[model samples]
Target: MEKKHTIAITVEDQPGVFTRIAGLFARRSFNIDTITVGKSEKQGISKMIITVIGDDRDLERVEKQINKLIDTIKVTEMPKKSAFIAELCIIKVAVQDKKIRDDIFSYAKIYDAKIIGMTDKTLTMYLVGESENIESYIRLMVPFGINEISRTGVTAISKDW
Candidate 1:
């Protein structure tokens, strides 16, 4: 059975490194669900969190392939039960009427989302939560007219040190 896997990779901070890493996935015909990269705690290094759906065998193969890349320092596949994962999402919704805007605010409050930016034509919200919670918020915002959405893919930490 196919399962969702979150892999965290620590790599050298060099130009085209991301391209090379992504190429490995493409070469295997894997469709990445989400990918987020940022500077790591160590200097001249970066951390990448990638979420993909694949069978256990395929995931093991992918992990091995990633390890062979020159720039990759380490790769860890987080265990589902022992991982604390969260993602950030920003959603822009079109709100032309006052009542609709108020309703949106009410929903945001219920979801613990913050109205970070707003204009007569758009309302931007910042939400941080588990993947499912973010998806749920996006689904609820659909009827309000979602203009655009930006997400930082799942970032996970091991529960045990």
Candidate 2:
């Protein structure tokens, strides 16, 4: 069965690690849904949180290829039962009148979104939260005329410690 898998990896702070991983995925025809990489708690180390939708075999192949990379220090699938995950999104939508802008503002407040930019006909909002909230916001803003959107794929940490 194809399902979404969240894999977290700790790797050395070395160049080409991302390229190598991305190349591996491309070679294997694995479609990455989201990938978030950043400096880990320990200096000189980095952590990557990847989300992919694939079958068990496909996921196994991806995991093996990533582990074989020289820069990869540790790799593990985030346990679904005890993981806290979130995504960041920025959306710009057209707002032609005060009533429409006010409606969007109300929705933004409900979603804890911040108005980052505005023009005579548009509003840009920044929202950091679970994917569900972001999706909901997008759905709500569609009626107001979504002009653009960018999303930072899922970043996660295990709650189990």
Candidate 3:
């Protein structure tokens, strides 16, 4: 069965690190759902949280290839129960009428979204939640006419010490 996997990787903070990691996924033809990278708690190091949908065998191969990278210091597949995951999305919708704006506001409220930017013809919303929750919001907002969308990808942390 194909399942969502979040892989956490720690690597040295240097140039071309992202390209090297992304190349691994591209070479394997794995569809990357999302990838988030940022500085880690340790100095001179960086962390990456990659979300991909694939079967167990594909995931194993990805892990093995990632391990071969010289910059990679550690790699771990986060367990479902032990990880707290979240993703951020920014969506701009076209709303020319009051009724459409009101309807969008109602839906955003239900999804705990915030109206971050607004203009006469467009409204931009910021949402932070699980990947599934964000997808649901995107589907619901499609009827309102989405003009643009930007996602911050996935970030996860282990719950246990």
Top candidate on TM-score is: 2
Choose the strongest candidate by lDDT.
3
Query: Using Cα atoms with residue i matched to residue i, what is each candidate's TM-score against the true structure?
Result: 0.92, 0.93, 0.92
lDDT of 1 by residue, 23-124 (tens): 999998886989989998999999999998999998888899999999999999987788888999999999989999999999999999999999999999
Worst 10 residues of 3 by lDDT: 78-87
Q: Candidate 1: misplaced stretches above 4 Å?
A: none
lDDT of 1: 0.92
* Candidates in order: C-alpha RMSD to true structure: 1.5, 1.4, 1.5
TM-score of 2: 0.93
The better candidate by lDDT, 1 or 2, is 1
Top-down TM-score ranking: 2, 3, 1
Show pairs that collide, candidate 1.
none
Against the true structure, candidate 3 has what lDDT?
0.93
Q: How many clashes show up per model?
A: 0, 0, 0
Model 2's alpha-carbon lDDT is 0.90
